[model samples]
Target: MADTGLASERPLRSASFRWFLGGQSISLLGSAMSPVALAFAVLEATGSAAWLAAVTTAALVPMVAALLLGGGVADRHRRDSVLRLTSVGAGLTQAGVACVLLTHQHPAFLLPLCAFSGVFQGLTKPALRGIVANLAAGRGIQRASSLLASVRNTTKIIGPTTAGLLTASVGGGWAIAADAVSFLLAAVCFARMSLPDRPQRTADDPTMLGALREGWGYFSSQPWIWAVTLAFAVNNGFNLGVWQILGPVVANGTIGARGWGLVLSARGAGALLASVVMVKLTVRRPMGPALASMSLAAVPLILLGAGADTLWLAAASFVAGVATEFFTVVWETVNTTHIPERLLSRVGAHDEFWSFVPIPVSQLSTPFLAAAFGTASVAVLGGATAAVAMLLPLLVPALRRIEIHRQGE
Candidate 1:
C-alpha cells in the first residue's frame, strides 16, 4: 500500500463534509425505500415477471443513454449546482408517479415516467462522484468513502424493512412518494453546500463531444478501470439486475413478504458491519483483495437458488453483503486516487455506463430465462457466472499492480 498519511483522522469533522454526509445519509435511506417498493408495486400491478422487467429496463435505458452527456455537463459546470437541480427534477418525477398511482388509475405511463426520472437521476451521478472526491481530498479518501458507504449501508438495513412494512400497510405508491420527499430534502441540503471552484476553461476548450472523447481516452487508457468495469458488466448482469427482478418473487412465494424484508435486512446488516470495519481497514493490492471479496458475494445467490430456509438464506445474504462492502471501499479508494479530479466525473460516468449497461439486458432477459430454465436454474447459473467473472480482471497485470498514493507524495 502506498503511504496514506494520518489515516487515523476522520474527514467528517469538516462541517461542510458533515452536512454533505448527513444529507446523503437521509437521502439514501429514502432512496433505499424505492427499490423494494417499486418492485413490489409492479409485481402487484401486473402480476407478471415480464412487466417488472419492462419497467426496470425502461428506467435504465435513459440512465445509460444519457450518461456521457451527463458526465460532460458535470465536468463543464458546477457539480453542486447540477446535483441540486437534478435532485429537484427527480423528486418531481417520482412524486408524479405516486400521484398517478394514488389516483387508482392504470399505470399506463409508469414506464415513461420512470425513464424521465432515470434521466434526471443519471445526470446527478458524475456530479455526486465529483463532489465526494472534492470534499474528501487529502483527508483520507479511503476512510471518507468507507464512511459514506457506512451511511448508505446503515440505511439499507432500515430502508427495505421500512419499505416492506409501508408496502404491506399503506401501499408501494405511498412508499415511492416518501422517496420523492427524501430527494427534495436532499436537494435542500445540496443547495446549502459550498465547494472549491472547478478549473476555468476558455472558449477554445473542448466541446461536449470532445470532452467525452477525452474522458473515454483517460478511462480506456487505465487498464484497471476498463477491465474491472468489463467484469462488473457481467457481474451486475447476474447479481444486481437479475436479483432485483427475481428477489421479490422468491421472497413472496417462499419466504413471505415480511420474511423477505428480514432477509434483506440481514444483507444490509452484514454490509453495515463491513463498512464499519472498512473505516479502520486499509488493504494493499486492492484489486486482488477486492476481487476475492466479490467472489464471496455469490453465496447468497446459490442459497437463494436452492430455496434454502429463511434463516440460512439470510445468513448467507449477510455474509455476501459484508464481502460487497469490502470490494466497494477498495474500488472507490483506487478510483479517487487514480483519476484526475477534473475528469473524475466524466470518467465516473463512463465507468457507470459500461458497468451498468448490461443491467437492463440482464433484467429484461431474467424473466425469459427463468421461464425457460426455471428460476432456480437461472439463479444458480447467474451466481456461478458472477463468481467466475469477478476473477477475470485479475489476469490483467496493470490492474493487479495498481496502488494508491497520497496526492502530494
Candidate 2:
C-alpha cells in the first residue's frame, strides 16, 4: 500500500461540512422523488415499456455527454456558482414537468422537461465532485463521502415512498409539484454555502478538450483506474440497469408499488445504519484484508437471487443496501482521498463511465434477459456478477496497494 501517513483525526474543523452535506441531502431527497413521479406519470399515460425505456434513455443522454466536459469547466470556474446554476435549472425543470402535467396534461412535454433536468444535472456532476473534494480534503474525506452516500441512500427511504403515496392518492400532478418545491428548498440550502476558492488558472490555460485529454492521460496511466472502471461497468450494467429497473418492476407486481417503495426504503435504512457506524471505523489502508471482507459482504446475492415473498424481498433489499453502501463508502472515500483534484474528475469519470456505460446496455438488454432466463434468474446473474467482479481491480498491483492520501496536508 502507498504510504498514507495515517492520522486519527477528521479533516474539517467546524460543522460547515455537515451543513453542506445536509443541503445536498435535501437536494437528493427531491431527486429521489423525481424518477418515481416521472415513471408513474409516463406509465399512466402511455402504458408502454418501450416508451418508458425511451424516456429513460433520453434523460441520461445529457449526463453521458456533459459529465466529462463539465469536469473541465469545474476546474476552470467557480465551482459553487456552477453548482448554483445547475441546481436552479434542475429545480425549474422539475417545476416545468409539474406544470405541464397539471395544466397541459401531456407525456410528450414531460419527457423534454425531464431531459432538460438531466442536462442540468450533467453540468452539476463535476462541481459536486469539486466541492466534495475540497470540503473533504485531508482527513475527513472518507467520512464525508460516506455520509454523502448515506444521504443519497437515505433519500430513497423518504422520496420514493412519499411519491408512491402521492401518486396513489392525489395523482402524479401533486407529486410533481412536491418534487419541484423540494428543489427550491434544496437551492436555498446550497445558496447559503461558502466553499473555499478553486485553483486559479493562468491566462494561457488549455481549452476544455485539452484539459479533458490531460485528465484522461492521468487516469490511463493508472491501471487501477481503468481496470476498476471496466469491472464496475460490467457490474453497473447488471447492478444499475438490471437490478434497479427489474427489482422495482418485479416488486411492484409481487409486493405492490408501495411495497416496492418499502423495499427501496429498506435499502436506504440499511445504508443509513452502516454509514453511521463506518464514519467512526477507520479504513484499512491496505486493501487486502478489508477488500476481502467487502467481497464477502456480497453474500446478500443469494437472498436477492431467489424470488421474494414481500417480507423476504424487503429484507433482501435492505441487506443488499447495507452491503452495497459499505462497499461504496469505503471505495469512494479511498478514491477521492488518493487521487489529485485535477485528475480526480477523470478517475471519477473513468469509474462512473464503466459504472453507467452498462446501464443503457442493461436497460436495453434486461427485458430479453428476463424473458429468456426469468426475472429471478436475470437478477441472480447480475448479483453474481457484482459479487465476483470486485476482484477485477485487485488483479492490478497498483490498486491493491492504493491508499487514501491527500497531496498536501
Candidate 3:
C-alpha cells in the first residue's frame, strides 16, 4: 500500500484531502485579513477605541459561549456538513457587514452582525479541528497538521499586507466583502469533500450538558492535558492577548512603525520555516520538547521589554515564532493520535475554551497593568510568568515520560 501510494499514511494522495487543504488555506487567508479590515472600519465609523472594543467584545462573547455546544453538534452530525453550513452562515454575516458599510447605514447594525458572524465562526472550531482525523484515512494526521500549519503561516504574511492595501485603496467594506467571498469558496470545497456521518445519538448516550461533563471529566483525568491547558491559559493570555495590545505600542515607540512591520514579517517567515522542518522530523517524546519550545517563546517578550534594537528584537521574534509553531504541531499530533475520535471534538472544544477564556481578560487588563507597572515591567513579568507556567507541566510524570510515536510502546 505504501509503495503504491494508496496507503492511509499518504494524505497528499487523496483528492478530497487536497481539496480540503485548498479550501482551508483560502479560508484562513480571509480570516487573517478580517482583523486589519475590521479595525479600520470601526475606527472610521466612530473614531473611538471604545466603539471598536465594543464591537470586538460582541464578537468574542458569543464565540466563546458557542464552543462547547458546537463541539456537541459536530459529534452529532456530519462534520463536513457542519463546516459547509457554518461557512455559509459566516459568509452571509460578513456580506451583511460589507453591505451596511457600503450604504453608510447606522453603525448599530455592525454590532449584531459581528455577533452573528462570531456565532458561525465558533460553530466551525470543533469541526475544523476534528476533520483532519477523518481526512487522514487512519494515518498521516501529523503530516496533514504540518501542511495546514504551513499554509496558515504563509497566509499570515500575505493577509495583513493585502488587507492594508485593500483598505487603503478601496474601503474596509470591500476588503470584508473579499473575506465573504473566500468563505463562499470554502463552503463550496467543504460541500465537495466526502466524510462519514457520526454515530446517531442513542437513549443511553449523554445529553448536551452530560456530554460537556464527560468531556470535562476526560480532560481532568489527564494530568498532562489539564496542566498544559491551565498553563497555556496564562501563557496565551500574556504572550498573545496582552502582547496583541501592548506589543504594538512598545514597537511603535521603540522600533518605529516600519521596524515593527519587519519584525512581524520575520516571525511569519520563521513559522513557515518551522512548518517546513517538521515535515520530516517526527517527535518520539513530544511533551518535554513541546513545553520547552513554548518556554522559548518568552525570550522575545523579554527582549521587547529590554527595549532592544530592532535587529535584536526581530531575531528574537523569529526564534520565538519557530518555537511556537513547533509546539503547535507537536501538541496537535498528540491530541489527534491519543484521543478517541468519538470524543475528540468535544475535548478539543473544552481545550479551546480554557486557552481562550483568559484572552479577553488579558486584553481588557493590559492597559491597566501597563499603567500600574509600566510597559517594560509588564512585559518582563508576563514573559517570566509564561516561562514558569509552561515549565510547570513537566512536574507531572505522565507529561515527562510520554512518547508520541507509540510504535515501540
- Structural similarity to truth (TM-score) of each candidate: 0.95, 0.87, 0.89
- Comparing 1 with 2 on TM-score, the higher-scoring candidate is 1
lDDT of 1: 0.83
**lDDT by residue for model 1 over 61-180, one digit each (tens)?**
899888888999998888878878988998999998888767766666788889999998789888877766767665368778888899999998999889889888888889889989
- Candidate 2, 1-409: lDDT as tens digits: 1112231134334344655676688788877777776666666677655556666766776676677777777777766667777878888888888887667475677668868887887778767765667565555676677668778887878988887787667666777777777767766776766665666777787777888888888877878678767776776766666765675456545665577667667777877887877776765564544444444434444455576576776676677667667767777776676678766665565556556766777777777777788877887777777667766667778777776553343
Expressed as tens digits, the lDDT of each residue in 1-409 for candidate 3 is 1122452477787776777888898788888777767766666677654455567767876887888888888877889899899999998999998898778787788989999998897799988878888877434777888888899889866776676667666767887888899999999998887776577778999888888788888977998788888999989877776666666566534554345556665676788899888877887887898898888888878878777887887798788879889988888888888888878888888888888887777767776788789878988888888888888889999888776673234
Taking all chains together, the TM-score of candidate 3 against the true structure is 0.89
- Model 2 scores a TM of 0.87
Model 2, C-alpha of 206: deviation from truth (Å): 1.7
Worst 10 residues of 2 by lDDT: 1-10
Ranking of models by TM-score: 1, 3, 2
Better of 1 and 3 by TM-score: 1
RMSD of each: 3.3, 4.4, 3.1
